[model samples]
Target: MADQHRPGTLGHYVPYLLGRHLRAGAWPPEIGKRAILVLLGLLAVVYGLGFGHMLGNHDLSATLRANFLLGLYGTVFTSTLLVDFVPSYRPVQRLLPDHFPVSGRRSAELAFLLDLISLRRLLLGVFLAALACVPGQQRVALLGVALLLGATALSFGLRWLLTWGRGRRHPLVAAYAAVLALAGAWLTLAATKSLTGPLAAGLPWLVALLPLGLLAGQVAGLGPQFLNRNLVRPALDTAESQWLARLSPEWKAYLRKTWPALSMGLAFKVFLLVASSVMQAKHGSDSSRSIFYLVFLPVISFTYANNNLYGYLYSLTLNELQRLGLTSRLLVLYLRLAVPVLLLDCLLSAVLLVALFPASTWPLLGLLPLSAGVFLALGLWGSLSKAKPVYKNLDLMNMRNNASTLMNILTLATAATLYFMPWWWVRAGLAVSIMLTAVVPVRRLLSNHGPQRRQLHHRLQSM
Candidate 1:
């Protein structure tokens, strides 16, 4: 009887031991490292600087303070995601201690709770709290504490729900993230306006208390056995299998050329197509219906430019492309990759056109070249300016640079005006602007003999 009871007692202690092992290191050394910490610190300093303006200029307005805290919470909330979603590629059994409990749900909960109380995460919360305290805003620090704990409990429950039972459903995870983003956006917008209802008043309180229910469930042995090799293996395997099975090879290869590899932009593009359809349905004959396209068309550049233009250059090493003779041949190669993406856009646009008006959509296709020229030229100019071209450097000017961003805004406004002005000559102005923008940089890249070109080639080889 004493020996039988000894097994149960030892099993209970396994969780505490696992927690101790995880807390010892698993993180700063393994995950964040020195460089990442430095980057994170710099970002925090930038946020602190921004907050300094709020304190100085606005005298800590409630709306501004709330916005600042919510943004800070978003940054800290990333840690919960990193811990739960990022799988350890190492063999599962090796991560655990020897002689751990067989029925390990309780131990798993303990280990996960300990993992959430990570030193790095706590230090970040403390750092942000310190920054918030500089302006004598104690509420910010209190909000940070609540956010960290709430996010941890939420993530823990989600991770368990995803990993438990028969198989992993990866779409549910993406859907969850999208819903959360939309909800946050709605709340942020709503917070700026007046609140009058009991629901509005109680929402924050309800959210603050929500994590308690999840935490209680976790302690009751409802969480997944994260340390269990059998469970971890199947769940991860199923997720990978489902992902590959869902996407075709052609579509997958196309995405490889794009940023935000999930094709989130494509999703947005499809959304615009639906909007176009609705506009066509409502006021198909009205001249003002063209406003729908005018407003949303420029945004396509955001999705298209990175994939077909800026990113295309790096897809092949410079040395490899040089062998193909970089002038006309490279231009052809660029078109080959770019045309399919444009064609997809055209197909979607054509569908909207057909649904709205059963006439030729041929004129609308002209907008494709205009978009291609604008974004591609920008990409080429950005690449030419940098000695060692990085993706972000070639993408756009720093968004924080008000002057460059303002110039882009003006350009978009001017182009959209030219597009919708109804006169052929006015529309021709857009084409002229695009041609002037695109031709020179493209010619320079294709010319292929200069110190700059040689330097770029050398850099590519070294990389």
Candidate 2:
């Protein structure tokens, strides 16, 4: 085959090539359409702000500039290391057969270049560009851009080192401890103005470039050496199946049917929780003000579960749903089950808040109503929409959506309510909202349109 990395005579047909590749398999068309909609929505927001004079504020401009720079640097740095971190791409190393017609070096290069053309890179670029449009101090913006670029390169390089080092018998625990200590010292210096002088001002910028340099060095030296290394496969265990078998019949059935989806959901939740905990531990003002972590942790974890479960439910082929003769009952079951699951999530969140922020326990409890209400609203929306889940192994699109205005509004509203209202009253209001949102929607869905039911039946009949 011709080199995949090299431009062909149809260089101008890059878009066509991409389209063909994307459409070749069982591609979820909805995901692409939704992604385009989101991009357009963000652009509209930026243009609207410009017209409304919202971006005219000096402070806003300064913030935007800083964020833009930071975003750009972060994007590039993250993108460079993406191939190493993303598991799906891990197999690329083994994909190139040793006896292939092409030279080994050329094959590796092609694989690396193809990895660079990933959807992750494209989305990162779009997001970074959007961040750049945010108004901010020009210098801060410039600095952010520079820092983002530098950090990205550095991250890529460091990731390569980490991968290489993982093969050795080094004490990773000690390395982690050292890193934590260094981070603590850096934060202390920054907070105490110990590093505020001329020396300190230039250090961060310089440090950012180190990653890029390291990545370059790795690419030059270690790239070929690592390319042909034997891929290691971890041993698999079926212990979970034994445990699942011991559960109640209903629970066992659920596990049997949805284990893969559930496992993926649980893994994603654990990752987020751990990441949030680490961030809070590092940056939180004492352990007392860890309310943000408490608020976010359970909510996100449960949201991921709900979304994933819905995805698993949808993954059942239309024929399968029909074969079971349970489509109506299942939909009803979904609506019924959503409440307790969401309530459980709310209760868990409240407990975390109480544990972390006893002083603000009353206020935190008050926020529960709001959280529950939002969850119920979203659940109903998802159910009624009955949109097929676009189950990308990596949910890049959903991640982007979570960072958007709709999510921002929810966060802001929750924050504002917590700030202004008395704890007891806010709690009361939250309770009322949850009941209204959840109950009202369920009633509406049951009463008004039986169209979804009819369609389900029609589809089954056709099959």
Per-model TM values vs. the true structure: 0.51, 0.54
Q: lDDT per residue, candidate 2, 1-463, as tens digits?
A: 3555453122333456446544432244678765675675566456434522443455667546434434344445444444345433233342355544444344434444434444444444444455456665344335444545554443333433444534334343344334334434544465445775675556555555554454455455555544445334332336866776677643443344334333443444444444445555666634433334334433453333343334334445344344653344454655555556556556655554455433633454655656556655555544434333433443433432322234334534544454445566655666466447555445544554456544444533331
Which residue segments of model 1 deviate by more than 4 Å? 1-127, 131-136, 164-202, 219-224, 231-251, 257-329, 339-371, 380-460
TM-score of 2: 0.54
Q: Which of the numbered candidates is closest to the native, going by highest TM-score?
A: 2
The prediction achieving the highest lDDT against the true structure is: 1
The alpha-carbon deviation from the true structure for residue 360 of candidate 2, after best TM-score superposition, in angstroms, is: 5.1
lDDT (10s digit) by residue, model 1, range 1-463: 5564453234445567656665563334545355555566567666665664565565667767655655565556555444444322111222344364334554555545565655446566646655665666565556556656666665655555454543245444454455356436535555455544775545544454466454565546443444454344344367767886797543444343443322434555565556565555666635345555643354443333432242335445364446743455545545565566555655665555556544554466566556555545443443333323234322211212211233345445655665567776756676577558767656765786465466556644443
Score residue 264 of candidate 1 by CA lDDT. 39
Model 1, position 215: C-alpha lDDT score:
54
